[model samples]
Target: MFLDNEDKISIDRVVEELENRPELQHVYLHKLFKRDHHKGQRYHEKQISLYAEYDRPNLLPFLRDSTHCPLEKALEICQQRNFVEETVYLPSRMGNSHSALKMIMEELQDVDKAIEFAKEQDDGELWEDLILYSIDKPPFITGLLNNIGTHVDPILLIHRIKEGMEIPNLRDSLVKILQDYNLQILLREGCKKILVADSLSLLKKMHRTQMKGVLVDEENICESCLSPILPSDASKSFSVVVFHCRHMFHRECLPVSNTVSSVQFCNICSAKHRGPGSAVLEMKK
Candidate 1:
C-alpha cells in the first residue's frame, strides 16, 4: 500500500497515512521531496520543527538528509540540546564549518591547540605536558623556559631536568639549566667559606693571647689549669714546662710523650719552645 504517482490523494493525505509508519516515513518523504519541490520544502520544514521538539537524537541525521535543512539551524539545535559529542560530527555534515571544526579539534584533544590554550589560560597541567613533549628538543625547551620560567616551579623544572639526564639529546639543555641553578649555590657556599676563614683568624688571635700568658692580680696563671704560677713555688718548679710563647703549665698537664722530639711547639700558639732540652730553671728574684 505505497503511495505512487497514480494515487489521486493530496500530499497532506499521503503524509498523514505514512505518519504512523516510521519505517515507511523516510522513504515516502524522500520520494515526495524528489517529485514535488514545493511540497518537499514544506515537509522538510515540518520535519525539522518536529525533530527539534521531540526527536533530538534523530535531528542531525534528519537535517543531513533534508535538502531544505540549514546547517546553522542544526548547530543551534545541537547547542540547545547540549549535544557536545554530536557537535564533533557536525562539521563533516556541514562541509567543514570552521567553528564546528575547532569544536571537534578541541574535543579530540588537539595538541597544538591545547598548548596554545594552556599558554593563553596559564594552565600548569597543560604546560607540563608541553614541557614533557619538548624534552628531546633543546631549542624548544630553551624557548619554553624563557617564556614560562616565572610561571613554572623552578624546583620541579630542575627535577625534570635531572630525570632527563639519561637522554643524550637533552644533555646539553639539562647541563645549561643545572649550571645556572648551581651557580647560585656555589656563590652561597663561597660566602660561607669567607665567613669561616674570618672566624678562624679571630680564633687564632685569641689562642695566641691565651698562650702568651694569663695575668691574675699581678700573678701569672697557668692557661691549662687556671692555677697561679708563683715564682716562690720553688718545690713545684721542676713540675712545670714553659713554652717559647712565655706560657707555663704543669708537666703533667702538657701533652708530652716520654720520648722527647727534636722540637715541641706550644699546643696553643703552635710555636717551637726554645731552650735546653731538660734544664732546671733558676728564677730571678
Candidate 2:
C-alpha cells in the first residue's frame, strides 16, 4: 500500500511510523528514491541529514548516488557529527581540498593517505602544509621521507626534522635521498656530454665546408664603389674583404666609422649597388 503513490493515507501512516524510527528513515527515503527519482529529489536533503544523524554505514553511498542535497548543509551536518570521511569528502567535493587534507592528517592520522591526497591535488601550498603538519611527528616524517623525493625537495624535510626525534628506517630514507641526488647528477653529466659531442660534430662539418673556399677572380666588383675588387696587376699590394654572400669590397673603398657604439653603414653601398646579404657587426677594441 505504501508503494502505491495514489494511496496518500497509507503512505502518510507509514511515514509517521518511520519518523519514530530514525534509523529506518533513510531506508524508506532510499525506497522512495528508487521508486521515483524526480519525486525523490524533494526528500534528498532530508535523507542526507537522516543518514548523517544516525551515522549510517551507507552515508557515502547515499551521497554518491543522490543529488539536490545542499552540500554546504551536508558538510555542516557531517562536521557536527565528527564524521571524518564525510567531512573530508564534502570539503574536497566543494573544492576545499586543503581543509579535507587537514582533517585527514589531524583526525585520521594516516600519513600515506595525506601524502597521496597532496599528490593528487599537486598544489605547492598543499604540499607545504603537509610537510608542516608532518614535522616533529616521527612516523609522519618517516613516511614523507620515504616518499616525495622526486616530487619535492627532500632537503626541505631533512633540514626541518626535529633535533631529538627518532625515525624508523631513517637510514633507508637517507640512502634513497642520496641515490636520487646521484641519479640527477648522472643525468646532467650525460646531457652535457651529448651537447659537447654535438658541438664537436657541428665544428667538424663547418671546417669541411670552409675548406671548399670561395673562388675570387678579376671579374668580382666592389659593392660600395662598383669597381673591380682585383686589379690586373698580379703583384699589386691590395686588401679586399669577401663576404659569404660573394659581395666583395676593397679595404679603402668602404667608409670607416670611429664612433664606439654606432651602426656601420655605407652611403656608397646604398647609393651605388647592394646585395641581399645582411648582418649587424659590433666591434670593440
Candidate 3:
C-alpha cells in the first residue's frame, strides 16, 4: 500500500484506535516524538495529553496533525506499526515468506521510500528478506547505490553479526554489493594483489616503461635446473642496476636471456625505447 498515494487512512482514527487498544498502552509514543524533529510547526503538549485520554471510536481529526511531521519522523511511525501489529509474523495474517515478499515488492514502488525503509531494518533476517525480494528487481540495488552516491553515505546492512545467521555468506554478500557499485577499491590494497604462476615477470615487463623498476623484496629459490644461479633468485643478483636509458631492475631478477627484441616498452614505465638494441643493463651502484 502506497500510504502517501493510495492509502487514504486518516491518521487521527489510527491514533484513536491506538490509544484504546490495550496492546499499545505500553508503547511510549512520547519517547519517539521527543527524539524526532517537528520543524517550526507548533504542537501542543496539552493536546497530546488530552488526546491520549480519548477512548473514542474515531479520532482521525486529531491524528491528522501528523501531516505536519517531518518526512523522516513520519516514516518511523509507519515502520513502528509493523512491529506493533506483529500480525505480519502469522502466516495466515500476512502469508508466508513468498507472499510477504511479493507484497513488499508491490509496496516498494517508491524507490526512495523503500530505501528509507530498508535502512531502518536492523535485523539481518529482514535485510536478507529485502535482498531476496530485490533479486529480480534491478532498481533495488541501483536505487540504493545511487542514493548512497548522492548522499555520500554507506549502507548499514547489518548492525552486527547475530547468532544462527550464515556469517560467511553474509560477508560475501556485502562484498558483492560493494563490487557491484564499483566501490571495492575502498578495501585494502594488499587484498587486490594479482597472483599468478608467472605474474612476477609479466608484471615486471608491463611496468618497465611506466615506472622505475626496482625489486625491493626477493625470496625462495627455483627448483628447476640451476645454471650458475637459479632464475627465482635473480632478484638478489644486484642491489640495483641502471639501464642505458636510465630504467632500472633488480640485477638478480633480470631475465636470463636478457631478450628485449620484441619488448618495446620499459618494464617499470611505458617509455618508448627506439634506441639501438635497447639500453644495456649496467650496474647502478
- Which lDDT tens digits does candidate 3 get at residues 1-285? 212322474434444556666334313333233334242134333233333344222122334444353333322343454422122212212225443333455643555554454454334454555555554445564554444332223354333223454443444455656664565454434354644535887867755753554332333221122222223454554334444445555545556544354443445555555433334433433
TM-score: the better of candidates 2 and 3 = 2
Candidate topping lDDT: 2
**How many clashes in each candidate?**
0, 0, 25
Off by over 4 Å in 3: 1-105, 144-285
User: lDDT per residue, candidate 2, 133-244, as tens digits?
Assistant: 8897889988998888877999989889888788989999899888988988999999999999999999888656644557666787878788887777777777765543
Once fitted onto the true fold, the runs of candidate 1 whose alpha carbons sit more than 4 angstroms away are 16-39, 49-61, 89-96, 108-285
TM-score of each: 0.29, 0.52, 0.22
Model with the higher lDDT, candidate 1 or 3: 1
Pairs that collide in candidate 2 are none
Q: On TM-score, who's better, 1 or 3?
A: 1
Give the Å error, residue 102, model 3.
8.3
Stretches off by above 4 angstroms in model 2 are 1-25, 31-39, 53-55, 177-285
Model 3 earns a TM-score of 0.22
